[model samples]
Target chain A: MNILVCISHVPDTTAKINFTADGSALDPAGVQFVINPYDEFGLTKALHIKEAQGATITVLNVGGPETEPTLRKALAIGADQAVRINATPTDAITVAKSIKNHIQANAYDLIICGQESIDYNGQQVPAMLAALLDVPMVNACVGLTIDGSTATAKAEIDGGHATYTANLPMVIGGKKGLVEEKDLRIPNMRGIMTARTKPLSVEEGLSGSNTAAKAFRKPAAKSAVKMVAPDQVNELVRLLHEESKSI
Target chain B: MILVFVESWNNQFKKASFEAVSYARKWADMAGCSVKAVVSSGASNPESLAQYGADSIATLDLAATGPGMAGQLSTMMDGVQGVVVAGTAVGKTLAPTLAALIDGALSTNTTSTPSSVGPVVVERGAFSSKGIETIALSEGMPIVSFVPNAIGIEEKAGAGAIESGSASGTDKVAVSEVSVASGKVALPEAEVVVSAGRGLKGPENWGMIEELAEVLGAATACSKPVSDIGWRPHSEHVGQTGIQVNPNLYIAIGISGAIQHLAGVSASKTIVAINTDPEAPFFKAADYGIVGDAFDVVPRLIEELRAFKAAN
Candidate 1:
């Protein structure tokens, strides 16, 4: 089986997010980069499927050279090969188009990606990919299993859950409960050394008008904390109604 | 016309769907147009959408078809200027796919109105709820998915016209199935949530947490470490990578609030924390804090809740 896993390079979750001077884009200085956490779930799930069924996992990314490290990390985590679309990943449309162009010639059995990237939280690329390919897609899948040519997956729905079944050549987005942490593979030292010798191809990004960040600004600061004594329930309610008006 | 995706489960409209319809209605009013709601299930009562300000409702008999929500919604996006959906997992999944199918731009988890311009501008959450961002979509209709529970629902009386639609059933690809746990409230839909962390000691002590949750009609959650160690299922993990929730009241027990965990619940209306450590990080983010052991404080709190319920 052949699988394509989408990956994105995002700032580490612990990094303090800040804007550049003039507030146009993300301030990259002092920001540590990492594979998006949600995407890690996709990569690990792909690796698990590959190990279980002898599938080949290909990692795809839409970013500049800065994202090569993320691709290498996927390689270290067990992807057989990687493809990097050389671009800044300006918006979801551009990224999706680049992916579509690259995969148009190849037929994939399964396409996996994170539900959303932590940095922008756009949550559009996988869906966009599925639409562009005209294939079935499921997002935020919490569980998945294969039965012959059919794949059964559990996707998170509002207030409940839904089970979906799609044939081969479908897309899925990863979320928690879909893949356990123990399933994550850390490439051995030899695998890390072998990754340098593996194929990591870079393709030209599609040319298109991309959305530009006009300005960046910080959110309004929260007010000082107010203390309410445990016995002052009535007072709290009165204050919420009269002063806070948030009730 | 503005299109709203009315989310439903077990033939009931979700609370978030009401907000979605309200938002679409408000936008339609601003745009000098009408709002239409689309449901995947024909079994749904379209007339009820009128009370929530939907000018019309469209239902597709696809409940028994499959889980190709994006494919089904895409066929119905004709003559629509804008699309609004609840930014739940399903919405987050389908909205982008729909946008891509239409070759449009999308904004996720938006919290405020879009700016009127050639290219639409929308405000959305960023930096794990630490900031808000205004993004501009320069091409096609903007597909906006609003965060669940962020927008308040408002009712307006109107006789919304109902329409039925059909589409050719497509072959299923990548079939999916779910086995829901019995007697457990889905964390996302719960009004109250009781969560614990490593401070709880072991899975054996989860009975206290369950008891508190049961008494309050709440769901149970665990911190990342707790879930990582198998004390709780990954479905109950609340953090950046896990399920983010914004319930009316959230109670954290025996947990030191990590920044990741706080990001998930900081949007909640009210938060209370109980931990043996006076300086647990959760206290700083909590609306109320009690410095005590869960072994001592949980039973008392449960008793107080029971007394309060009985008295009321």
Candidate 2:
């Protein structure tokens, strides 16, 4: 079986978010970039499938050359090959379109991606790709298992989890329960060396919809926390009900 | 007409659906358009939406369509100017697909209502809720999925005529059964949330959390470690890799805030952290802090909440 895993380049979750001087774009000056944490979960799941089911894993990302290090990291984590769609991903729709075009050219039995990227948090690409490619998809899947050509996935909803079944050539938007953090593979010295020589290819992508961001601003700074002693817990309740009007 | 997808499960309108209705109603009033609703489920209560500004409700018998409601939504988006949906799991799937099908723009987890900022625009969290990004739809209709609790739900009586329909054909994928936590407030729609981390030590100590949540009418959540160890359901895990919530009030019990955890909840209107260690990172992000033991503090906190409720 052939598996495709899509990853995104995002600022570290702990990075300080800042807007440009004119407040039109994100200021990348002091931010440290890393593979989106959710995408890491998807990549780990793909590697697990590769190990257990003997599938070739190909990692894909639509980004500029700056995303190569993240792609190499996926290779080190055990992807068979890496393909970079040399395009500045504007929005989820365009990104999914590029992915759909790529997947149409090179077929895959399964496609995996995070529920949403940490940066934009649109949570749209997986669904859009599935719709564009006319394939079945499971959103926010927590547990996934592939038995031959049949795939059964467990996805948690508002109150309970839904069990879904679909054939191969499907898409899954994965969350935490799909793969545990402890199962993530770190690049060893040998794996890093091998990643340097791994097959990395770049391809042009389709220019699709342009969803633009007008401006960006940081969230309002949190005020100093109101300290309430353990015995004065009721005061906190009073504050919530009366002052904040939240209760 | 402004179209809003009323999200229902098991034929019941979820709280987020009402929120979506109220949100659309406000925007529609501004746009001088009627508010129309579409429900894919066998909605138990279609008339309830009428009081919340729905002029008409289109109920679709999507039982045969399975979980993929995008086709039905695409058909419903016809002749609609602005589309509003609750940013729940189902809406997240349908809105994007509809946006793509219409060659329009889509914005999820909107922190505020879409307004005309030289074009249709919506404010949504970016970079894991650390910042807010104002997105403009380049052209075509705008599909906006509002985050729960961001827009207040209000009542305004309107015509509420129900029209029934169904998807033309079946979908490729099929959901065998929908497993939802019965009788509990869903995390996404909850206005108040009380989340526990490993600080509580074990699942057996969850009684107070449940009691507090019950008294306050809030939802219960947990940290990644708590869920990974089977202490809580994975559905209740809130973090960057888990469910991101924007509740009005978020209380953390025994959970030292990790960056991943904070990423999911920083957009909350107010945060209260109760941890034994005052230096826990969650304090920096919280509006209130109580440095104490959960065993001693949680029960007392529950008692205080009960007393406050009784007084009110």
**Candidate 2: where are CA atoms >4 Å away?**
B63-67
Worst ten in a row by lDDT for model 2 chain A: A205-214
User: Over the stretch B249-273, how does candidate 1's per-residue lDDT look in tens digits?
Assistant: 7888888988788877877777777
Considering only chain B, what TM-score does candidate 1 achieve?
Answer: 0.91
Candidate 1 lDDT, tens digit per residue, A1-247? 8889999898888877789777777888999998888888888888778777779889999988888988998898788999999987878888898998888877789888888787877778887888788787777788888766778888776445678777878888887666877776677998788788778999999866435456666665444445554444444344434564433
What candidate 2 keeps of the native contacts, as a fraction, is 0.80
CAPRI-style grade of the A/B interface in model 1: acceptable
In terms of lDDT, the poorest run of 10 residues in model 1 chain B is: B168-177
Docking quality tier of model 2? medium
Note the clash tally of each candidate.
16, 7
Q: DockQ of each model against the real complex?
A: 0.46, 0.76
